[model samples]
Target: MADKQDLNAGFTGTPVEQPEGLAKAAQSAASRVKREAYAVTAGARDHPHTASALLLGIGIAAFGFGYLLGRSSAESSASYWR
Candidate 1:
Protein backbone atom coordinates (compact mmCIF):
# COMPACT_ATOMS: atom_id res chain seq x y z
CA MET A 1 0.00 0.00 0.00
CA ALA A 2 2.82 2.43 0.80
CA ASP A 3 4.48 1.70 -2.55
CA LYS A 4 1.14 2.17 -4.34
CA GLN A 5 0.73 5.55 -2.65
CA ASP A 6 4.27 6.57 -3.69
CA LEU A 7 3.51 5.52 -7.30
CA ASN A 8 0.49 7.87 -7.44
CA ALA A 9 2.39 10.69 -5.65
CA GLY A 10 4.40 11.57 -8.77
CA PHE A 11 5.27 10.66 -12.37
CA THR A 12 8.55 8.80 -11.77
CA GLY A 13 8.98 6.52 -14.77
CA THR A 14 9.68 6.64 -18.52
CA PRO A 15 6.70 7.18 -20.83
CA VAL A 16 4.80 3.97 -21.46
CA GLU A 17 4.31 2.58 -24.99
CA GLN A 18 0.85 2.58 -26.61
CA PRO A 19 -0.92 -0.69 -27.44
CA GLU A 20 -1.07 -1.83 -31.08
CA GLY A 21 -4.29 -1.57 -33.17
CA LEU A 22 -4.43 2.25 -33.17
CA ALA A 23 -4.43 2.38 -37.01
CA LYS A 24 -7.22 -0.20 -37.12
CA ALA A 25 -9.23 1.90 -34.66
CA ALA A 26 -8.78 5.05 -36.79
CA GLN A 27 -9.84 3.13 -39.94
CA SER A 28 -12.97 1.91 -38.19
CA ALA A 29 -13.89 5.48 -37.27
CA ALA A 30 -13.47 6.56 -40.91
CA SER A 31 -15.66 3.68 -42.07
CA ARG A 32 -18.43 4.75 -39.66
CA VAL A 33 -18.31 8.30 -41.05
CA LYS A 34 -18.59 6.96 -44.63
CA ARG A 35 -21.62 4.84 -43.74
CA GLU A 36 -23.41 7.79 -42.06
CA ALA A 37 -22.68 10.00 -45.07
CA TYR A 38 -24.10 7.38 -47.41
CA ALA A 39 -27.27 7.06 -45.35
CA VAL A 40 -27.79 10.81 -45.30
CA THR A 41 -27.35 11.10 -49.05
CA ALA A 42 -29.60 8.11 -49.78
CA GLY A 43 -32.43 9.38 -47.58
CA ALA A 44 -32.37 12.93 -48.90
CA ARG A 45 -35.19 12.39 -51.42
CA ASP A 46 -38.66 11.87 -49.85
CA HIS A 47 -41.17 10.86 -52.51
CA PRO A 48 -44.87 11.58 -52.06
CA HIS A 49 -45.80 7.93 -51.42
CA THR A 50 -42.99 7.51 -48.92
CA ALA A 51 -44.02 10.69 -47.14
CA SER A 52 -47.64 9.49 -46.99
CA ALA A 53 -46.56 6.14 -45.57
CA LEU A 54 -44.47 7.84 -42.95
CA LEU A 55 -47.41 9.98 -41.85
CA LEU A 56 -49.70 6.95 -41.76
CA GLY A 57 -47.23 4.98 -39.68
CA ILE A 58 -46.92 7.84 -37.21
CA GLY A 59 -50.73 8.13 -36.93
CA ILE A 60 -51.11 4.40 -36.31
CA ALA A 61 -48.47 4.48 -33.60
CA ALA A 62 -50.15 7.46 -31.92
CA PHE A 63 -53.55 5.75 -31.98
CA GLY A 64 -52.05 2.58 -30.55
CA PHE A 65 -50.46 4.54 -27.69
CA GLY A 66 -53.75 6.26 -26.86
CA TYR A 67 -55.56 2.91 -26.86
CA LEU A 68 -52.97 1.56 -24.42
CA LEU A 69 -53.37 4.54 -22.10
CA GLY A 70 -57.15 4.08 -22.03
CA ARG A 71 -56.63 0.39 -21.30
CA SER A 72 -54.31 1.12 -18.38
CA SER A 73 -57.26 1.92 -16.09
CA ALA A 74 -58.59 -1.63 -16.57
CA GLU A 75 -55.10 -2.97 -16.05
CA SER A 76 -54.77 -1.10 -12.78
CA SER A 77 -58.16 -2.37 -11.57
CA ALA A 78 -57.22 -5.95 -12.46
CA SER A 79 -54.03 -5.63 -10.47
CA TYR A 80 -56.07 -4.44 -7.48
CA TRP A 81 -57.99 -7.76 -7.44
CA ARG A 82 -54.72 -9.66 -7.61
Candidate 2:
Protein backbone atom coordinates (compact mmCIF):
# COMPACT_ATOMS: atom_id res chain seq x y z
CA MET A 1 0.00 0.00 0.00
CA ALA A 2 2.85 2.40 0.87
CA ASP A 3 4.70 1.57 -2.36
CA LYS A 4 1.51 2.08 -4.38
CA GLN A 5 0.94 5.47 -2.75
CA ASP A 6 4.55 6.52 -3.44
CA LEU A 7 4.28 5.44 -7.06
CA ASN A 8 1.04 7.41 -7.50
CA ALA A 9 2.50 10.49 -5.80
CA GLY A 10 5.69 10.53 -8.00
CA PHE A 11 3.86 10.68 -11.32
CA THR A 12 4.01 13.92 -13.29
CA GLY A 13 0.77 15.18 -14.88
CA THR A 14 1.69 14.65 -18.53
CA PRO A 15 -0.92 14.22 -21.24
CA VAL A 16 -1.27 10.77 -22.80
CA GLU A 17 -0.66 10.33 -26.55
CA GLN A 18 -3.76 9.96 -28.74
CA PRO A 19 -3.84 8.50 -32.26
CA GLU A 20 -4.46 10.89 -35.20
CA GLY A 21 -7.20 8.58 -36.46
CA LEU A 22 -9.27 9.25 -33.33
CA ALA A 23 -9.04 13.02 -33.89
CA LYS A 24 -10.13 12.62 -37.53
CA ALA A 25 -13.05 10.43 -36.52
CA ALA A 26 -14.20 12.95 -33.89
CA GLN A 27 -14.05 15.82 -36.38
CA SER A 28 -16.04 13.85 -38.96
CA ALA A 29 -18.73 13.02 -36.36
CA ALA A 30 -18.93 16.67 -35.31
CA SER A 31 -19.29 17.77 -38.97
CA ARG A 32 -22.10 15.29 -39.55
CA VAL A 33 -23.93 16.48 -36.40
CA LYS A 34 -23.63 20.12 -37.49
CA ARG A 35 -25.03 19.30 -40.94
CA GLU A 36 -27.98 17.38 -39.52
CA ALA A 37 -28.76 20.16 -37.04
CA TYR A 38 -28.69 22.73 -39.81
CA ALA A 39 -31.01 20.63 -41.95
CA VAL A 40 -33.52 20.23 -39.11
CA THR A 41 -33.47 23.92 -38.32
CA ALA A 42 -33.98 24.81 -41.99
CA GLY A 43 -36.85 22.36 -42.30
CA ALA A 44 -38.56 23.70 -39.19
CA ARG A 45 -38.15 27.25 -40.43
CA ASP A 46 -39.58 26.35 -43.82
CA HIS A 47 -42.56 24.44 -42.38
CA PRO A 48 -43.90 26.41 -39.44
CA HIS A 49 -47.32 24.74 -39.50
CA THR A 50 -45.90 21.22 -39.18
CA ALA A 51 -43.54 22.22 -36.39
CA SER A 52 -46.29 23.99 -34.42
CA ALA A 53 -48.66 21.02 -34.78
CA LEU A 54 -45.98 18.63 -33.57
CA LEU A 55 -45.18 20.85 -30.59
CA LEU A 56 -48.86 21.17 -29.63
CA GLY A 57 -49.44 17.40 -29.90
CA ILE A 58 -46.44 16.67 -27.72
CA GLY A 59 -47.54 19.22 -25.11
CA ILE A 60 -51.06 17.80 -24.92
CA ALA A 61 -49.73 14.24 -24.54
CA ALA A 62 -47.40 15.31 -21.75
CA PHE A 63 -50.17 17.15 -19.90
CA GLY A 64 -52.54 14.15 -20.19
CA PHE A 65 -49.86 11.79 -18.83
CA GLY A 66 -49.13 14.07 -15.89
CA TYR A 67 -52.85 14.51 -15.08
CA LEU A 68 -53.38 10.72 -15.04
CA LEU A 69 -50.38 10.17 -12.77
CA GLY A 70 -51.50 12.86 -10.34
CA ARG A 71 -55.05 11.49 -10.15
CA SER A 72 -53.79 7.93 -9.57
CA SER A 73 -51.52 8.97 -6.72
CA ALA A 74 -54.25 11.03 -5.05
CA GLU A 75 -56.73 8.16 -5.27
CA SER A 76 -54.21 5.64 -3.85
CA SER A 77 -53.30 7.87 -0.89
CA ALA A 78 -56.91 8.59 0.23
CA SER A 79 -58.16 6.71 3.31
CA TYR A 80 -61.35 5.30 1.70
CA TRP A 81 -61.13 1.94 3.56
CA ARG A 82 -61.25 3.57 6.98
Candidate 3:
Protein backbone atom coordinates (compact mmCIF):
# COMPACT_ATOMS: atom_id res chain seq x y z
CA MET A 1 0.00 0.00 0.00
CA ALA A 2 1.42 3.43 -0.92
CA ASP A 3 1.78 5.32 2.38
CA LYS A 4 -0.94 7.96 2.85
CA GLN A 5 1.67 10.68 2.23
CA ASP A 6 2.22 9.41 -1.32
CA LEU A 7 -1.55 9.18 -1.84
CA ASN A 8 -1.85 12.99 -1.53
CA ALA A 9 -0.74 14.80 -4.70
CA GLY A 10 1.26 17.31 -2.55
CA PHE A 11 -0.69 18.99 0.27
CA THR A 12 1.82 20.34 2.84
CA GLY A 13 -0.46 21.96 5.42
CA THR A 14 -0.52 20.47 8.97
CA PRO A 15 -2.40 17.16 9.12
CA VAL A 16 -5.29 16.72 11.57
CA GLU A 17 -4.30 15.46 15.03
CA GLN A 18 -7.60 15.52 16.97
CA PRO A 19 -10.66 15.13 14.78
CA GLU A 20 -13.12 15.05 17.72
CA GLY A 21 -12.76 18.69 18.79
CA LEU A 22 -12.86 19.91 15.19
CA ALA A 23 -15.97 17.84 14.51
CA LYS A 24 -17.72 19.23 17.63
CA ALA A 25 -16.95 22.83 16.67
CA ALA A 26 -18.19 22.21 13.13
CA GLN A 27 -21.46 20.71 14.40
CA SER A 28 -22.14 23.60 16.80
CA ALA A 29 -21.37 26.20 14.13
CA ALA A 30 -23.57 24.44 11.58
CA SER A 31 -26.60 24.47 13.91
CA ARG A 32 -26.32 28.22 14.66
CA VAL A 33 -25.00 29.24 11.28
CA LYS A 34 -25.15 32.92 10.23
CA ARG A 35 -24.27 34.67 6.98
CA GLU A 36 -22.11 37.18 8.85
CA ALA A 37 -20.11 34.45 10.64
CA TYR A 38 -17.26 34.74 8.16
CA ALA A 39 -14.81 37.61 7.60
CA VAL A 40 -15.64 37.78 3.86
CA THR A 41 -19.15 39.02 4.81
CA ALA A 42 -17.68 42.34 5.99
CA GLY A 43 -18.89 44.41 3.01
CA ALA A 44 -21.55 42.00 1.77
CA ARG A 45 -24.55 44.31 2.28
CA ASP A 46 -25.61 47.84 1.38
CA HIS A 47 -25.11 50.12 4.38
CA PRO A 48 -26.73 53.48 5.25
CA HIS A 49 -24.11 55.59 3.46
CA THR A 50 -23.89 53.46 0.32
CA ALA A 51 -26.81 54.95 -1.64
CA SER A 52 -25.92 58.58 -1.15
CA ALA A 53 -22.20 57.78 -1.62
CA LEU A 54 -22.90 56.00 -4.87
CA LEU A 55 -25.07 58.90 -6.07
CA LEU A 56 -22.28 61.35 -5.26
CA GLY A 57 -19.75 59.20 -7.13
CA ILE A 58 -21.97 58.95 -10.23
CA GLY A 59 -22.64 62.68 -10.15
CA ILE A 60 -18.90 63.42 -9.97
CA ALA A 61 -18.23 61.10 -12.91
CA ALA A 62 -20.92 62.80 -15.00
CA PHE A 63 -19.58 66.23 -14.14
CA GLY A 64 -16.03 65.26 -15.09
CA PHE A 65 -17.20 63.73 -18.39
CA GLY A 66 -19.21 66.86 -19.26
CA TYR A 67 -16.27 69.09 -18.32
CA LEU A 68 -13.89 67.14 -20.53
CA LEU A 69 -16.29 67.11 -23.46
CA GLY A 70 -16.93 70.85 -23.17
CA ARG A 71 -13.19 71.58 -23.04
CA SER A 72 -12.53 69.46 -26.10
CA SER A 73 -15.33 71.12 -28.04
CA ALA A 74 -14.12 74.61 -27.14
CA GLU A 75 -10.54 73.76 -28.13
CA SER A 76 -11.66 72.36 -31.48
CA SER A 77 -13.90 75.39 -32.15
CA ALA A 78 -11.07 77.80 -31.33
CA SER A 79 -8.65 75.91 -33.60
CA TYR A 80 -11.20 75.89 -36.44
CA TRP A 81 -11.60 79.69 -36.19
CA ARG A 82 -7.78 80.33 -36.04
Candidate 4:
Protein backbone atom coordinates (compact mmCIF):
# COMPACT_ATOMS: atom_id res chain seq x y z
CA MET A 1 0.00 0.00 0.00
CA ALA A 2 2.80 2.39 0.90
CA ASP A 3 4.65 1.59 -2.35
CA LYS A 4 1.53 2.22 -4.41
CA GLN A 5 1.01 5.57 -2.67
CA ASP A 6 4.65 6.52 -3.16
CA LEU A 7 4.42 5.71 -6.88
CA ASN A 8 2.47 8.91 -7.51
CA ALA A 9 4.31 10.99 -4.89
CA GLY A 10 6.55 12.51 -7.59
CA PHE A 11 3.48 13.75 -9.48
CA THR A 12 1.92 15.34 -6.37
CA GLY A 13 3.32 18.78 -7.41
CA THR A 14 6.02 18.76 -4.76
CA PRO A 15 8.59 20.09 -7.28
CA VAL A 16 7.92 20.51 -10.97
CA GLU A 17 10.44 20.16 -13.77
CA GLN A 18 9.67 21.03 -17.40
CA PRO A 19 10.15 18.29 -19.97
CA GLU A 20 13.01 18.63 -22.52
CA GLY A 21 10.63 18.02 -25.41
CA LEU A 22 8.43 20.95 -24.35
CA ALA A 23 11.45 23.29 -24.34
CA LYS A 24 12.44 22.16 -27.85
CA ALA A 25 8.87 22.68 -29.12
CA ALA A 26 8.76 26.20 -27.74
CA GLN A 27 12.12 27.09 -29.30
CA SER A 28 10.98 25.72 -32.68
CA ALA A 29 7.76 27.80 -32.57
CA ALA A 30 9.67 30.98 -31.72
CA SER A 31 12.11 30.38 -34.59
CA ARG A 32 9.25 29.85 -37.08
CA VAL A 33 7.55 33.09 -36.02
CA LYS A 34 10.78 35.02 -36.39
CA ARG A 35 11.27 33.67 -39.91
CA GLU A 36 7.71 34.61 -40.93
CA ALA A 37 8.08 38.14 -39.55
CA TYR A 38 11.33 38.61 -41.45
CA ALA A 39 9.69 37.45 -44.66
CA VAL A 40 6.81 39.94 -44.25
CA THR A 41 9.24 42.76 -43.50
CA ALA A 42 11.24 41.96 -46.62
CA GLY A 43 8.11 41.85 -48.77
CA ALA A 44 6.89 45.19 -47.49
CA ARG A 45 10.27 46.77 -48.14
CA ASP A 46 10.19 45.47 -51.73
CA HIS A 47 6.63 46.70 -52.35
CA PRO A 48 5.92 49.92 -50.51
CA HIS A 49 3.02 50.96 -52.75
CA THR A 50 1.08 47.75 -52.22
CA ALA A 51 1.65 47.88 -48.49
CA SER A 52 0.44 51.48 -48.31
CA ALA A 53 -2.72 50.68 -50.27
CA LEU A 54 -3.47 47.74 -47.98
CA LEU A 55 -2.99 49.90 -44.90
CA LEU A 56 -5.28 52.62 -46.33
CA GLY A 57 -8.03 50.11 -47.09
CA ILE A 58 -7.83 48.66 -43.58
CA GLY A 59 -8.08 52.14 -42.05
CA ILE A 60 -11.13 53.08 -44.16
CA ALA A 61 -12.91 49.85 -43.21
CA ALA A 62 -12.20 50.42 -39.50
CA PHE A 63 -13.60 53.97 -39.71
CA GLY A 64 -16.75 52.81 -41.48
CA PHE A 65 -17.33 50.11 -38.83
CA GLY A 66 -16.93 52.64 -36.01
CA TYR A 67 -19.35 55.08 -37.68
CA LEU A 68 -22.01 52.42 -38.06
CA LEU A 69 -21.64 51.31 -34.43
CA GLY A 70 -21.93 54.89 -33.14
CA ARG A 71 -25.00 55.59 -35.29
CA SER A 72 -26.74 52.44 -34.11
CA SER A 73 -26.05 53.20 -30.42
CA ALA A 74 -27.33 56.75 -30.80
CA GLU A 75 -30.55 55.54 -32.43
CA SER A 76 -31.09 52.97 -29.68
CA SER A 77 -30.60 55.55 -26.92
CA ALA A 78 -33.04 57.99 -28.57
CA SER A 79 -35.71 55.28 -28.79
CA TYR A 80 -35.15 54.35 -25.12
CA TRP A 81 -35.77 57.95 -23.98
CA ARG A 82 -39.14 57.97 -25.76
Best lDDT goes to which candidate? 4
Question: Which residue pairs does candidate 2 place in steric collision?
Answer: none
The residue-by-residue lDDT of candidate 4 on 1-82, one tens digit each, is: 4676567644446337554798879978999999999998899999999999999999999999999999999999999999
Q: TM-score rank, highest first?
A: 4, 2, 3, 1
Error of 4 at 51 (Å): 0.3
Q: Given candidate 3, what's the lDDT at residue 31?
A: 59
For model 1, state the Cα shift of residue 70 in Å.
Answer: 0.6
The number of residue pairs in model 3 that clash at the backbone is 0
Off by over 4 Å in 3: 1-46
Q: Compute each candidate's TM-score over C-alphas.
A: 0.36, 0.53, 0.42, 0.60
Q: After superposition, how far is residue 47 of candidate 3 from its true place, in Å?
A: 3.7
Q: Which regions in candidate 1 have their CA more than 4 angstroms from the true location?
A: 1-46, 77-82
- Number of backbone-clashing residue pairs for each candidate, in the order shown: 0, 0, 0, 0
**Per-model lDDT:** 0.79, 0.87, 0.74, 0.88
Best by TM-score: 4
Q: Write the per-residue lDDT of candidate 2 for residues 54-73, one digit (tens) a residue.
A: 99999999999999999998
Q: Which candidate do you rate higher for TM-score, 1 or 3?
A: 3
How are the candidates ranked when ordered by lDDT, highest leading? 4, 2, 1, 3
